[model samples]
Target: MLMLLAAGLLADPVPVYVIAGQSNAEGYGVPHAQLETIDDVTVVWPGRAQKEVGPLQAGWGANEKMIGPEYGFGQAMQRHHQSPVVLLKTAWGGKDVWCDFRSPSAGDFNWAEQQMKTREEREGRSRKVGAFFNAMVDNIEVGLHQAQVHLGRDDLELKGLVWFQGWNDYCQWPVEEAGSPCGRGIIERYPHNLKHMLCDLREALNDTTLPIVIGELGVHGSDVPKSRSGWALRAFRTAQSETASQLDHCCLAPTASFWDTQATDHWECHYNGSAKSYLRIGRTFALHLLALDALPDGQTLKWQASQKGLQAMLRRYPPKSGGLALWGSSIFRLWERAPAHFSEFEVTNVSFGGARSWETLHYADETLFPIQPSTIFYYCGSNDVNAGADAASIAERFRLFSELTRDRLPHTKIFFGAINRSPEKKERWAVVNEANQLVGSYCETQDGRTFVDLNQVLEADDGSTRQDMFLPDQLHLTERAYEGFARVMREALEQKVQSP
Candidate 1:
């Protein structure tokens, strides 16, 4: 591994990608079954700027598999840009979107363990999540360190963050409310308290500009729960896009029909996904990360360490020991603007993989709100491509996304992730590409936003989309695809664009 410092202090910014959120992002993937050698090209993350890498390492492992979303995007990017790509995996196989993994150090684990054991006994099974609880924090803390060590940078040095959650939420969300405050032990806050977690995380990392890409979670079904499906999962998956839209530096990848199965060593009951979908999801988010760093003119939200925005907001609360400020979540530490003062922003992603325009639009309205972000980077219409949807439908989707952007943000960037082509019998690649062209063309009529034709840029010289560019099933691009996608955004941002 070429060290970052010795490789020459990144003349520009290091193309760092954070792989966060639940299982899919953290990797419940099955390692490839065979020991067949592909090539370094398949293994390398994007941004390396060179191809013809040697025979690749054996990705297949007994306890695990390596075919996940980031694989391709990372390879393509490294080859394309000569930039080092650091993927920090911070996924907890089964956790809720709102649950912030709490540490034992944060509270008394004995009480938590006792209560947990009591419940397990009542249910005639041992429900000790203590291992999972500790592992979650350990994974993130270690993953953050991995990024730091690999990227060789402080706070603002890393590039972007990718989030793939929802499955965990799908399994637990229904019952979460029943278990209030998690028995008052150390509690991982919920999405309802998302601001606390996000704001605090930003403060801790000191990277307000960190682009966060959250993959919409879909419960295609998992071994964890037989009933972890149906309306609850469907509705949550539909709504997850909103969570992504609301947050800055965050984008949502459609996971509606993206997963396939293989075996894994992580959870005894969970099977690894096709890994290609994971690869595509990773790439989807990476594209936005690259875009955030690439855009030259985008304004960034700055962090305030000293009491500037919080003091005013806190004064409304009752003063106990020090002041009302002390009572509020400490994340207010760097929150410069009061909630009232913070700009009301909006974002709507205009594309989908397997989802419909109406379904996506509906979820956008319901799930996305109180969004921290102003503009949405929409990438959709893939699944629809095979469904006989025309360019008009694609155009309509973009239009709907734009309108939703207007309603929520009132003032924000509404960039579109160019919906690319799919060759499945159901999806006519040519027509889908044309629809993307239409969406790009139509977006010109909108304001504070632009359409990025990442698909055009992602194509190989041969005119055929790189096979390694997508999953074996061929619905989406692999990790390299996301890397390629991100590079396009990087190139654009390097030139100039609007930002939050």
Candidate 2:
């Protein structure tokens, strides 16, 4: 191992991937001997010791007899990047997110602990909630330090995290007893708890946009009777999926489909101890990470130019104290050409083409919130639906965006533009409509937020987009479409101005 380190083949700033979860994450599969021979890959199996590093191998599991997803994950990453790869594996079997790895920011688990009747009962389960989180953080720091010393470089980058644990939170506790001290009712709280965990982890690591890939729970082929736990697992899975969709630089890897009964240790939830299953999940995670990493680091050239223009406009004719801002994707980008009638009020176009709700949320602090617009005409979600996001995920992310904006700019009123139909993305029209309904419903419940219906004018009598109003792509708008959108937005803002 020392000789390998001496080879100095790794590039400066080695890419480090952290894999954390419970038993499944701990790897129940039998180790493949060939994994230990992989070149340019370092495995930090903390379960093996406080500071253990070597070529990838098995024995990273809690039992020290099995391998987990890290084996395959490391291999996949190594294959993709020319630079050396480091696998930091930190997980324990039978650990729950509500208690074992619960983040401090998620709030105290005292309510859940108080449910225990006796001091002895409480004491028995009194381990800190973020115990594993602390361990993982420590391991990452130490791993980086050791790598810097041994690898002879200071450019080690903590690239991403892979999360696979949720069974404990969903199965061990009864969903029926959620909100009670006896159980954290983690099912209902899973999404929020998971979100808090992600936020706190990023803060601790000092990378707000660090990419994270969450693996869905359970082995699809397991004979474990889901007759009782099936609904609970589905609920937990939904929470995980929705959380990923709602956050930027986060994605979900469907691992249940990779479950192999032939290799699983326990058929119920753990992927059969099959090395193939773990390998597939790991590769899937790596692929998703690679895809996210491929996205442009900033807005496209055209959008950047548009942003500069908007800035110039703000400088020339500053909004009347708190003015109006139009925000969203391509539809709103073209709306930048709205009729001069919009100039009657202070208006700035902040839209970026192909922007998703998560992307909007990610840059809100810099782009939307700081401007402190009195009124925001928001149009987003079609791109997300086009990207395969479900209606629930789109709605959930938009909710987060709206809430964050409202929190930062309390006086600002928001008008959510219903997504316009696109003939090119016809298959996703249902999802778009559902997302619009969700957004409209949420706006209806808020005090300063209103839903602006663009479909009335943008949609044809047949319920498809108006052919003449769209560009050749059928996704973007023509001058006629922008005219219609501008008219609707102006009317909505006027109504808000006149009310009371």
- After superposing candidate 1, which stretches have Cα over 4 Å from the reference? 1-10, 30-64, 97-156, 173-190, 193-195, 221-228, 260-272, 298-500
Error of 1 at 146 (Å): 5.8
Q: Where is model 2 poorest over a 10-residue stretch in terms of lDDT?
A: 175-184
Alpha-carbon deviation at 21 in model 2, angstroms = 2.1
Candidate 1 local lDDT, residue 199: 43
The most accurate candidate by lDDT is 2
> Compared to the true structure, candidate 1 yields what TM-score?
0.44
- TM per candidate comes to 0.44, 0.56
Task: List the pairs of residues colliding in candidate 2.
Answer: 13-155, 13-156, 27-68, 263-272, 263-273, 263-274, 264-272, 264-273, 265-273
